[model samples]
Target: MSTRRTLLAGSTAALGLAAGAAHAAPSVTAPQPAAAPGGRPPNLVVVLADDLGYGELGAYGQKLIATPRLDGFPAEGLQFTDAYSTAAVCAPSRGSLLTGLHAGHATVRANPSSGARVP
Candidate 1:
């Protein structure tokens, strides 16, 4: 209905599709190095919901919003209670995340969703 809900729904659907595809698709990308006693490396799933508070999910402590799927992550996987971000906005923060550089050292200090090189 609303813009926020629409965006969230779309993002949620994309996430589900990506997860399903990763599991169903054949391994035709790369020859990953074997891990000790483990064939492949562990998969890391990062969900960055813009403007979502830490307590918004049921995993945390939100009574209003029912997030059963997300709540299960703590038991099945990892749940980070605290996290640090270089930027408050998504684009800049994600830029720093992918580059592993703090906001001060990163070139994309602002939201540049165009994926264009900044000079």
Candidate 2:
């Protein structure tokens, strides 16, 4: 198999294991936002990192990393321990996340090379 394929496979397996571990933990209820005035939607922010390990964050029990702000997120926001990415690779994962679909259902599955033409 190609290096990219191998890496994707490994990442998928690792993420699956992490998800299982998260599933074993107790669930937490997310706090709901207050209704906006004039029926306007509330602002939302999502932070995503590539190739970040679960144990690298202070909130996830990393004593070495000084993530004070991130550590405090649980107090004011909902934290999901069992969350998962739809794909092992960036392009596919992002597509699945945006579309709310799994890898099998997502339209884009892999990142094509710069010179590769995509339809």
Candidate 3:
């Protein structure tokens, strides 16, 4: 299997987060809603920027921009000190988000202006 496929398969099984199993939208009627009595997996929101630098946000060293949302989020939640993208450019950066693959394994590396299709 390709590296991207391998990474995705490994991550899904390790995390116990199944894929392709039809799930209802969040509602009270859903079966076994939310985690059990014990602590459950925290919601994950993976935000990726195409070319945004580490110092691009107000929380970072960007002095001019006023990013209230980004700055205030750390107060409510944890802020990671070291975060990086899968690639330095756009296309591969997006591929990582879709397939959960690393930059080295991304087939759609570089700018990829040739219109790539997602599986």
Candidate 4:
């Protein structure tokens, strides 16, 4: 097989392995906190930068590009270093983001592999 085909096959296999492991693992649910004094919920901003690797930021290990915006946002808000996207591609990654659901629970993961404009 060609190198491109080999790489694609490897990536597919890796995704399958991750899915299986996630399914086999026991589920743990955190306790819900009581509502605050006011009825309004906290404001949230979820930012997903496409094609960004973990080491692409100054907070990680990048020493080349300057990422002052990213470096400051987490400090002003919340910083979740352990968060992960369900897929390694844009379309599916976005599906999870807008719906507040995992890629495994969404139909988009199985179709159009990646890169579709959000409706």
Candidate 5:
């Protein structure tokens, strides 16, 4: 009688495991949105300033520079308050801009001499 009871208990546990495996829940996934029709990327423009502090612009709270022309730019364009250049000097920074790389990865690390002419 005890042997029969053990067999029945084992069979019931096996059946429960099989049922759980058979009735496993399907995975839910978020639906992907449709792509844009044109397949073209958005336009972008980058502006760099030399020897200019952030507060020197009227948009940045400068009152004495008389920056009327540049004041309206922030309203029409995207302005970044926390943006920084790759380099403190102009040459490496310009090199990074032209090459689409940071100063550490730029090929030209320093400004060329004034006597050195580009052919």
Candidate 6:
């Protein structure tokens, strides 16, 4: 992975996408937090970018890096435009994204330098 570290991990790999989850930290001006009123269970932020590619950000359009808070996660979280990763490295794609099992039945399939210990 070296076209200058894949353009420096696709230019410092960032995808914020934390919009209005009760506007605690994801602020555009703060004060728009009222929706979880019925059963409640929505707020989620699960961004994991190792090599970084999914149109490289700006909420998957990426017009030369602006990414206004990762373009506010498809208007507030949950955007998986045809996702696919079960190991291009990163310890078997984080052990099949924490144990769903894909990267050869997962469990740290690689990325252990030369010691590689996870028996």
In lDDT terms, how accurate is model 5?
A: 0.67
Model 2 regions lying over 4 Å from their true place:
1-43, 111-119
| Tens digits of per-residue lDDT for model 1, 16-90 | 766676677574233333474666655546786766778999888899989888889886877888877778887
TM-score result, candidate 4: 0.51
Worst 10 residues of 3 by lDDT: 24-33
- Which is the better candidate, 2 or 6, if ranked by TM-score? 2
Q: What is the model-wide C-alpha lDDT for candidate 2?
A: 0.68
Best by TM-score: 3
User: In candidate 4, which residue ranges exceed 4 Å CA deviation?
Assistant: 1-41, 74-78, 110-119
The TM-score ranking, best first, is 3, 1, 5, 4, 2, 6
User: Among these predicted structures, which one has the highest lDDT?
Assistant: 1
Q: If scored against the real structure, what TM-score would every candidate get?
A: 0.54, 0.49, 0.57, 0.51, 0.52, 0.26
Structural RMSD, model 1: 12.7
Candidate 6, residues 1-119, lDDT tens digits: the string is: 34433533443442222333444554444333346767564464567778888897888888898877767867686577896777787768866665556677555678878775775
Kindly give the stretch of ten consecutive residues in candidate 2 with the minimal lDDT sum: 25-34
Clashes of each: 0, 0, 0, 0, 0, 0
The whole-model lDDT of each prediction reads 0.71, 0.68, 0.66, 0.67, 0.67, 0.63
User: What digit string (tens of lDDT, one per residue) describes model 5 on residues 48-92?
Assistant: 677788899889988877887677778788566886677877778
TM-score of predicted structure 1: 0.54
Error of 4 at 19 (Å): 40
Stronger candidate by lDDT (2 vs 6)? 2
Candidate 3 Cα lDDT to native: 0.66
